[model samples]
Target: MRALRRWWHDTAGDLPATFWYLWAGILINRAGAFAMLFLSLYLTEARGASEALAGAVVGAYGAGGAVGVLLGGVLADRWGRRATLLTAHLVTAGLMVALALSRHLLLIAVLSALVGVVHSMPSPAFVASIVDMVPEQRRSRAFNLQFWAFNLGMAVASLLAGVLAEASYLALFLVDAGATLATALVIAWKVPETLRRPARTPRGVPRIGSTARSARRPGLLTALTDRIFLTFVGLTFVLAVLTMQTSTIMPLAMRADGLEPSAYGLVVALGGALIVLGQLFVPRLIDRRRKGFVLATSTGLMAVGFGALAVADELAVYLGAAVIWTVGSMLAAPPNAQINADLAPPELRARYQSVFYLTFPAASFVAPTLGGVSLQYLGSAHWLVVGGLGLLAAVGHLLAGPARERRVAALLRGTRNGRPATSASGPMPAGGPEVATDPVRT
Candidate 1:
């Protein structure tokens, strides 16, 4: 018991109080995250829409999220983290309420898009806030704590989503909106803006290249121009599409097999529940391992999990696949966050996060649009195809392995040699980062 307590303190004891609130706030919101849980089911089962069109609606939501993430990154840099979060929550809350009242297919699609735009705009800013607060050496622990909280909330809400879905689908929408409203108020009361804008250079005056480059706050254009970073983003998109299938395609398959909405909900909730139970220990299990090997292992687990789903007709079979992929998702979560944090220059931290985050929405757009059509025509075999893509993505991770090992070695050497470690994002800032890091723990 004492040893466990000591580990917790070492991992999270020094984080700032603001981060605790951010952690708590997101937990509250995610606990009510029922909208997406039932979105696919609701559209088809309740609204009497065709599977293809339901996928389109879901895809539109993802398309809007991509736009939101891009716009959010710019706003997070140009404005501040607090403002971006508040705007996203408030607008998203209003839209969620409106969505519950509407039944028109076109309007639902449009609202889904708008809700997507407003709903996910806070993502980059939220992640940047964590990067700003946590130290580099311990960021894996920091992200693990945050993700643990998220999965804990999701486990409950996802299960509750099934319950609420069984009762009244509209109730899920209202609960979701209420949670966001409460979250907005909590943030307005507790959280402060963390992003720091760099000083603008005087026009026509030649500035030092290194200094100008250091201070130049990058945006969407600057982020996308990097070829290596784009490769990372593409790789993320592939894995995301495989993971995203549960939200759109898997439930449809289960329903086709005669399972009820609640059955799907309980099955899907296992993913979050497993993460909640195991995320903390999973990081420990992989500690000191090479990042490339860890990523490859994760993708392989997901490939197997999703591939197995092609043959899952029974409840136990579905639940088993959920456990496999959920562990993979948890194993990969912390390293992925650490990688992006390491990738961000102070001037471009939030925007870089936004760029990487593009994969979630990108996967959303691709998974549903393609998975929906494929499931319609190709039938259960579509899961096999999705599984193949997961494997291909795993192969991509392995191919990138040598370069990754070299990079990790160099960083280790630099740290041991009394030089500060650098990243693909370049040298760490001298002392003051984009946000203050003093711990406010009592």
Candidate 2:
């Protein structure tokens, strides 16, 4: 008991107070995150929409999210994190209420998309704030704890959403909106702006230290242009596609094998259980390892797990596969965030994060489409393809290690030297190049 207490203390201790407030806000917000989860059902059951229209509306939401994240990152950099987060949260709450009260199909669809946009806009800001506040040495643990909080909140939401939905779909919307408002209030009351503003010269030019505007202001395109960082983003997209198979293809495969929906639900629940329970321990296990090695190991585990799905027919076999991939997920979460943080310049951190955030929406679209095609054509062989992708990602992470390390070292050196930092590709030249001054609320 004493040892367990010590471990708990060590795992959860030492993060800044503001981070804890942010963490608490995350927990509160996610605990009522139900709109997307039940959107289709609400459309069909309450609004009497056709399945095709419902699906389209959901797709529109996702598309809006893709746009939202990029916009959010830029806003976080320009308007400040506190303002962007507050605006997004409040806007999200308003949209949720508007969605519930909305009756027209077109209006409903538009509201859904708006909700997606506002809700997703905060992601880059949240991650960028974490990176800004937490020191590099403790980031792994900080990210792990943050990830754990996310999963924990999600678990509660899943359970509470069902209960709330039983009362009325209105409850879901109202509760989600209320929770979002709560998050906004928390940020307004507790969280301060974390974005480091560049000092201005007497002539009113933004400059970093003695460099006097050495690097051009990094725009969203900068992240896309950095070859090394782009490589990392691409690999992460592959990982997202692989990870998505659990929700997209796994159940379909199981149903084909004659397992009941209950069994499938149980299997998925088990994976969620493992994550909520086991993720906190992972930082301690992998924090000391090279980021490349940790990522490689994680992808390898995923490869093995998803590959085993090729033969997973029985309940036991399915549970075993869940265990394997869940373990991989535990390993991957912290390092993924850490590396993303490591690669981002302070000026462009949110933009880089937004680019990284794009992977999930992209993967969500790609995975189901590709997985369906693969299952139809390749049958069980689809799992093999999934496994192969995981292995490819693992290999990519390993090969990218040396370059990534050097880039991180360079970034650290530049920061320590108090100069404008360069990105992974190379030195960015002086003065403004295509700097975007237009604003959008995250």
Candidate 3:
């Protein structure tokens, strides 16, 4: 018991107070995250919409989210993290209430998109805040703890959301709104603004007090133009697509093999269950390891797991595959996040994060479509294709390793010297040691 307690402390201790506040807010918000989870059912059962329309409405929400992240990233850099978070959360609460009361399908669709925009707007800011607060050496542990909180909240929501829906779909919206409001309140009360502001420059005169002109804050175009960062983003998207397979294609394949929906649910739940239980130890496992090797190993494990699905017909086989892929996911989460942070220049961090975040929603859309078509045409051979893609992505990470290491090293040196090295975004302002270093108990 003592050993376990010490291990837990080593893993989760020493983050800042504001980070804990953000962490708690995330947990509270996600615990009641029911609106998206059951939106299709709500539309079909309560509002009398067809399946195709429901799907389209959901697609609208995803499209809106894509726009939101980009907007949020710019706002995080411009308006400050706290303000952006507050705006997103408070507006999301209002939209949830509006969504609950609306009856018309078109109104619901429009509201869904609006809700998606406001709800997603905070993501880049939230992550940028973490990068701003946590020191580089301990960031892996901080991110892992954050990921665990998210999964834990999600696990709770999965159990409670169904019950709330059974009672009244309206309750789902109200509860979700209340949770969002609570998170907003938490941020308003506790979390401070984390966006680093540069010395003010006169309009059109370009009179800057600091010599760090890169601090002028570049737009999303900067992230788009960054070749190495774009390479990392592309690989992250591939991993996202591979990860989506467990939720999207795996279920269909299982059903085709005569398995029941309950069996699939149980199998799928295993992955989340594993994450919630074992993710805390992830930082210890990946600590000080080479980022490329860690990512390649993770992708390889997922490849083998998904590849095993080609022959999986029994419950036991499915569970074993779940274990392998879940471990891979656990391994990948922190390093992927840390690498994204490492690659981003501090001045353009939020924009870079926003770009990184685009992968999940993009994968959420593309994976199902591609996986569905491949399953239809390729049969079980689709798993072979998935394995091959996963391996290729793994190799990509390996080949990209040296260049990434050099980039991170240069950024670190610049940070220590109180100015960023000249790179794709040009000379970046000093970013290290800005946040207070006082350790806060978790």
Q: Top model by lDDT, which number? A: 1
Clashing pairs in 3: none
User: Which 10 residues in a row give candidate 3 its minimum summed lDDT?
Assistant: 433-442
Give one clash count per candidate, in the order shown.
0, 0, 0
Residue 418 error, candidate 2, Å: 3.5
Candidate 3 Cα deviation (angstroms), residue 351: 1.5
Better of 1 and 3 by TM-score: 1
Off by over 4 Å in 3: 1-6, 38-56, 100-108, 162-170, 200-217, 245-268, 307-318, 369-387, 424-442
Per-model TM-score versus the true fold: 0.90, 0.82, 0.82
The TM-score of predicted model 3 comes to 0.82
Kindly list the per-residue Cα lDDT of model 2 for residues 67-131, writing each as its tens digit: 88889999999998888899999999999999888889999878877876887899999999988
> Compared with the true structure, what per-residue lDDT tens digits does model 1 show for residues 110-199?
999998888779899889888777667767887988888888888888888988988998999999999999999999999988875555
At residue 252, candidate 2 shows an lDDT of 58
